[model samples]
Target: MSKCPRCFVSLTSDHFAWTQASGTTTEADPVASAYHGGQVLSRKIVELRRPVDAHAGWAPPPQHAELELGGPVREVCPTCHYVLVDGWRNAQVTCIAMAGARATGKTVYIAVLIKQLQLLGESWGAVVEPFDSTTEATYRDHYETPLYEARGILEATPAAHTGNPYQREPLIFSLGHWNNVSQILVIRDVAGEDLENPENARAPWLQFFAHADGVLFMFDPLKVESVTNQLHDLVPTQERVGGDPRTVLRTVLGIIGLGTPNLAIILSKFDALQSLQSVEGSDWSRIMSNPGAAFSRDFSLRSAPYHDGDGQLLNQEVRSLLKKLDATPMVMSVDQPHTGRPLPNRYFAVSALGESPVGDRLHASGITPFRCLDPVRWVLATRSVWHWQ
Candidate 1:
C-alpha cells in the first residue's frame, strides 16, 4: 500500500487507479506491493487505513461533504490530479501557506523555517531531504542559497509561471520511519505579493491555500506605529513595505472560501520586539523583560525540544500577544466563523533572522530561527507520526 500525498489515504494494490504505460491497458503494472511489519501488506489493510479521498479524480460521498463543514474543494493537484481537501491524507502533512503583504518577511521566514526544521528533525533521528529534483532546485535557488550561503534576504519570490516559480514547489522531507512505516513532510511556500494582489486571488496559483493542511498567516509588527516609534531610538527605522495585514488576511480567507485548514497566525520579524526589552521607559520594554515568559526565551539556543505541552502554552501566549497588538479581529475571522463553523487555529511568533539587517544584507549573527517549528510540529503531532529511533 502507498498513500496519496495530498490526502493521506492508503492506496492498496487493488484500489489504486493505474494508467497503462504506452497507452495500453494490458501493459499496466499491478499496484506495487507495500511492506508492512515484515510480510507484504494486503489490499484490505490499505483500504481500511484510507483517511479520505480528496484528490482530483476521487469524489467523497454527499455525507462527507456535510461533515466537512460545508467547505468547497478549491483546486486539484496538477501533478497527481488530487482534489485537495481536509482529511485527504492519513500521514498528516503540515502545509503552512505563507501570507502577508509584500516584504513582510514571508520569504525570509521560509528560509529560516527550513533550517530550523532541519535542526529539529535531527533530535528525532530523521534526516530531512527534498523529495525530488523539483524540490531540491526550488529550495536551493529561492530559499537555501541566498540566505544561508550569501547571507542576504531572499529576493522576492517570482510569481508562478515566471522566470522563477520555486516557491510553488513543495519542499518534502523524510521523517525516517515510525511503527515500521516511513513518514514524509511536505511544505509549500507562497509569495506574499500573490496573496496581496486582488487580481491574483482568482488566479490558479493562489488556489493552493484552499487545499493546504495548515496556513501560517504572517503579520509584521513593524507595520504598527507605536512599535516603530519606540524602535527609532534603539534600532534604525525600517522602510515600510507591504499592504495592510487586515486587507491581505481578509482576501486570503476569501480565497480559501471556507476550507477548513488549521490557521497558524504568526507574528513575523519579532527581533524588533526582542530589542525592546533593553529600552527604558517603554511599555514594550517591560513586556519583553519578563524572563519567565515564553517569548522572552529562545528555543534556538535553549535545551527545549519541540513537542505539544510547551507548544500549546506558547500558542495561547501568542494569541494573547496578537490580541494586544490589535489583530484579534483578524484572528477571530479565521477561527470564529460567521457561518457557524469554527476552524482549527493556533498562533505563533517567529524571527527568521535573529536580528534585522542594515539593508538587504543579513546581520552578523546569520539566521537563527525562534519558534519556527511550532506550526509544523503541531500539525505533525496531530498525526502521531514518529521518526525511527
Candidate 2:
C-alpha cells in the first residue's frame, strides 16, 4: 500500500474516500483544519465499500455508484483530506521529514537538494518533476526563487499554525518510472521554532515523523559558541542563529516515539567549519586541510553509485567531529536513544551553500553545494532504489 504524502498514512483501497472537485469551496473542512492549521474548503468525503472476492476485478463496489460515473471527482486522503496526486496510489514514495533548529540551513539545504536530485535523476535515466501543481508552485516561489533567482537567504519556515504556512503541503517530486513503478520523493520541512518549543510537540501534523521513511536532522556547527568564536574573523556574522541543537534533537526523538525512521544526523553549514583550514597552527585547520578525510571532499557528483566504503569512513569521521564540537549529548542520545526503539542512523556533513552567506545575501561566489545529496542517496540506497556498485 502507498502512503499519503501529507500525513504519511497508508492508503488502502478498503478505506478509500474522495470528493467532487466542482463543489470544493473556501469553507473550512474540519479534517483539513485539524492538520492544515485552518478551515480549508469542505471536501465531501465519499467512503467506498471494500471489494469482495477475486474476479471482482478493479471496479469499485456498487454502493458508491457515483465513482463509476465520475465527472470531476478528486481522490483525497481519508485522514488529512489532502488531494492525492494522479497515480499516487501506484507510485513508490520515499517520505522524508526535515528536522533542525532555527538557522540550521534546512531551507537552504532543501533548495540545493532538489537541484541535486534532478541532476542525479538524469544520470540514472530518470526525469524528476513535481507530482502536482501545488508542489510545483510552492517549490518555485518559496524554495527555488528565493535562493536561486533572488540570490538571498530564504526566510524562516513558518510554523504549521501560522497563516499561509507554505510548508503544510509536502514537496512531492516524481522521479520518473523505474522498473514499471513510479518513484516519488516526498519531503516535509518543519519549522524550527515549532520544534524548539515543547508546546507544539503534540500537534497532529507532527505525527508524520513517526511514519516517515527517513528523517534528516540537521545541526549547524556554526551555532556552537566555540565554533562561532573561531570563525568570527574568517566568516561574516549570521543574522540569525537557532536554539541549542540538543534541545531540538530531544524534541524530535520525543515526537518519533516508537517509529523506526532511519535518522541521518547532518552537520549543516560545513563550509564554515571547512574555512578553519585558514586558521594557522590550529588543530581544526589541520583537520579541515586533510585531503584524505571523507568530509573534506564530495564524491556525490560522480556517475558511480554511492560508495559504502566512503560513506562508512565519513560517518565515523563525522561522529568524531561531532564529539569534538561538544555535541556529545546529541551523539549519545542517538547512540543510545531513550525512545526504547532501535534507531538506525548515519552521520553526514553537508554545505548547501558551499560558502557562508553575507548578511541575507548569498556569497558572491554563487551556490556551490557540497555533499548535499549524500543523505538522500543514503536513504534511497537503503530502500533498494540504488546501490553501491
Q: Specify the highest-lDDT model's number.
A: 2
lDDT of 2 by residue, 79-167 (tens): 88888766789888889999999989998899899999899888978888988899899999999999999998899998777877898
Model 1 stretches with alpha carbons more than 4 Å out? 1-94, 299-306, 387-389
In model 2, how large is the Cα lDDT of residue 180? 78
CA-lDDT, candidates in order: 0.63, 0.85
TM-score for all predictions? 0.75, 0.93
Evaluated against the true structure, the overall lDDT of model 2 is 0.85
Would you give me the overall lDDT of model 1?
Answer: 0.63
Which candidate's TM-score is highest?
2
Q: At residue 203, what lDDT does model 1 achieve?
A: 55
